[model samples]
Target: MTRLVAVSGSLRRESANTTLLRAAIALAPSDIAVTLYEGVGDLPQFNPDIEHDAPPLVQAWRALLRDCDGIVVACPEYVHGVPGAFKNALDWVVGSTELAGKRVALINASGRAVHCHAALVEIITTMGWIVVDQASPVIPVAGKNYTQADMIGNPALAQPLLAALHAMAGVPAMAD
Candidate 1:
């Protein structure tokens, strides 16, 4: 099974970002195993001064990313850009070698409004990670204008996201 480390950018108890992560978890193929690293909000501010020996939490986060086959990020928009907390989390990943050449997929749960996808793509690419082009899942809120209540049950939204996950996991070949 492919081991995937998925992280949500939001730390709110009822955040749409967290809800979107849950949706991704449900979309995972049975063959791919997903392990979520919660409490992104609890991580300390990234400091270049303390780069040699990382804090326990930072170390733990890095370890997971390094070990996993791929990384999935679900994020919300802030001030027409990436969330500060989300940016900070990415900062902690700078010194780690795990991110180099890793496969990454991004999902923005912002409904209707055009997201910061372009900006985020630039940032992820600059980090030396391979962002899957065809697998982009930018869910601009469909018809109902989207709300927490509208997210959970819609198979239409879920199916495409599932396809993205399957692509990230890389489809297995048929046996001879």
Candidate 2:
């Protein structure tokens, strides 16, 4: 089984990015398991001095990334850049090898969030993760208030997401 961890860059209670990941979990094929990582908000600030003695949450976060075959990130742009909290979570593992050689799929919840998307691609690549271009898709769910059900039920949204999942899983995309 291919295990994938999905992360939402936003901490909002009703984040469209989170909703998109939830929809991804629902739409994933039986062979691919997409687990949503919800502990980003709980991680402490990045401290290079204390990285070796990392706290429990940081340890857990790194372990999750290490164990997963790949990661799916759905993020919303904040002030023309990646959100602070999400960037902080990444900083925790920046100096570690936990994510080295891992595959990554970036899901853009808003097409307007190009800045964050580019920044994320650069960050993920610099961290030694392979960014799957085929899996990175712009779904444009921003300001739509879209629910998981709405995304799963709509072919326009669902098809692209499924194709992304397939790409991450190394499964050939089925002919429509």
lDDT of each: 0.73, 0.93
Residue lDDT tens for model 1, 1-176? 88887887777777766666666776576787777779588889888988777789888888888999988877776676877877888888866765799888787666543456667788788888788754567765423345544564676676666766777878732222
List the candidates' TM-scores in order.
0.85, 0.98
Best candidate, TM-score? 2
The C-alpha stretches of model 2 lying farther than 4 A from their native spots are: none
After superposing candidate 1, which stretches have Cα over 4 Å from the reference? Answer: 111-115, 141-152, 172-176
User: For every model in order, what is the number of clashing pairs?
Assistant: 2, 0
Clashing pairs in 1: 111-141, 112-141
Each candidate: RMSD:
3.7, 0.8
